[model samples]
Target chain A: MTASIIEDRGEGSPRNGEADGFPTATPLPVRTSEKGEEENPSSILLGTSAEDHHIARMAALALGLSVLEAAIPSPLPGVKPGLANIVTLIVLARYGWRTAAWVTLLRVLAGSLLMGSFLTPGFFLSLSGALCSLAVLAASQHLPSRWFGPVTHSIFGAFAHIAGQLLLVYFWLIPHTGLAYLVPIFAAAALLFGTVNGLVAAHYLDKNPINHKIQRHREMRPDCL
Target chain B: MLSIAHIKPGDWLTLLLGALLTAFLGVTLWQGGAADKAIIRSGGKIFSVVPLSRNQLISVPGPLGISQIAIHNLQARIASDPSPRQYCVRQGWLKQAGEVAVCLPNQVSVELSGKQKNYDSLNY
Candidate 1:
């Protein structure tokens, strides 16, 4: 259905549309375009590998969630439900930590840019939060799958995320011990949101489990899949 | 929807640990420790450290003028500040360690400290 929409939009000039942004599985034309370009139009495609495209799409989804979350009024400056983390949890469970990290970091960077907070203290706080959560997720992903799942990972990630951001606020921004008073409130938020996000991720993963054949194929030849 | 059956032992463990962590943070970081002394600084320098137990009025010289810090009944407060805005003066009282009141324009600040150093370097 999505492919058909893309094809319909690109019907006017398929190669041009593909060259601009929308990457398709269709083979690139060997011959130069009628526009008299010397190089292959495929060269204009931003991402060559399937993984890059996957990450880009996932990142875009996460960015949308971040924007949506920003619209909701928060009680405290740093206290947010972090709805984008749900997408990160889903990506981590489905694809893997590396892909999830790419999606998450890209979302943070692009989200900051979109919010006009890039390079500001807010951006650093956000970056630190994302980094700490990613680290926790990466480590927790190694735990026994039989015993642990997305919810467990989400809790750890959420705690780490808030902890990192609070530490940054104390040392970098406020530089006062008074900030410690807010830790419990932020931690409570982390716990609540973490459990909620983790449950969502678990339910989604359970409904749409990884295809064993595809997983095997990817393990055999990672680039091809 | 996630049923109770979907939560594994590890998930329960995580939830438990997260609750414990939050409780720990609430207990330790929420209300600061009892302060024993008040450290006053003027012009970016430590002017004096006075015991909170002994009630006294400290007059510290700053850029704007003189700032008066009052310590009474184991509590400290900025009695007066020469700065335009009496922010520090209006900050009522400081009885907990790590509490601080700053008169920016006057370049005077007072911070409460506890016996065991409310927080170490690593806590930052």
Candidate 2:
């Protein structure tokens, strides 16, 4: 049992026959006869916890919002209202910054992949924006909660998002002083969208019925996530 | 459905800060810096770098013929080009830094360079 516990399984080994942290008395029966002689028996299956499920669900919600946003005709490129941020703000207020970061990054990666912009300049820009915003939120969330709320964090996150993208554009893509001229427009958009998203997040945080379930779950598992 | 009552004091502070930042960027970046010199390229090679202070006309020999460029009032423009399209001549004035006028047929291009760069990229 100790040897099996210490042994490193193949990278793609299936988890069906093994218990998580607990050794099984007998191996699960292999029903390979019905399937015939399999050419490839390797399989990959990860043991996901409840928190993973929550993050995956929230990430799917954010992706849905992103898809809706992509359909809207924006006046300027790289200047959208960032509707998906509402979910990040809600998650931050409920689950904390780590969970919020997970949701935001997953949204960016999955959203870009869905849009077929993976590994492109657009994907990098979105990645930088998400990272910068998450950093800002992580810091700003530490402020006294009495005065500050999701709205404040949202605005700061939005500004950081645009700042990150613009710097990337100036340094990597354009490398021109001319790009500075677009800063004002981008800043204005960030301010407007940040406030709007923050308000929406605040409203959702206050009114959503899901908060009760989340609160109950948090109380049950105080430190898992 | 949220209202003004839902806004917190910190939210107001953030709004004030974001607005001030946007205004500051608008004031500073909207206007490009004054150009310092004009760079003339003829047939893919640099013909000369002329100061905008000196009001003069430079005749650059290109593939087709001579192209004349004038600099005056801290601005430069293509006065005449042997190119049939006259696109460079029609460009009128290059007042800001990084502004460029090119005559493809004559293989002549004039650009303004200074401490700051002008907006040139439009990504769709």
> Which candidate ranks first by DockQ, i.e. highest?
2
- The 10 consecutive residues of candidate 2 chain A with the worst lDDT sum are A1-10
Off by over 4 Å in 2: A1-45, A209-213, A216-225, B35-114, B117-124
Q: Which pairs in model 1 have colliding backbones?
A: none
lDDT of 1 at A61: 82
Model 1 Cα shift for residue A97 (angstroms): 1.1
Give TM-scores of the second chain, every candidate. Answer: 0.72, 0.78
lDDT of 2 by residue, A112-207 (tens): 999999999999999999999998987999888889888899999999999999989888998876677789999999999999999988887666
The Cα error of candidate 2 at residue A78, in Å, is 0.7
Predicted complex 2: DockQ:
0.51
lDDT of 1 by residue, A1-225 (tens): 122111122123434322332233344435544444555545443323443456677788889989999999999888888888888887776657767787889999999999999999999999999999998888999899899988899899999999899889878888886677778999999999899888877877777656664365345443222
Q: Over the stretch B1-124, how does candidate 1's per-residue lDDT look in tens digits? A: 5675667799999999999999998998767688999999998899999999998999999988999999999999999999897989999999898789999999999999996566533333
| Span of 10 residues, lowest total lDDT, candidate 1 chain A | A1-10
lDDT of 2 by residue, B3-94 (tens): 87768898898899999999999998887678899999987899899999999999998878999999989999999988888989998999
Clashing pairs in 2: none
Candidate 2 RMSD to the real structure: 9.9
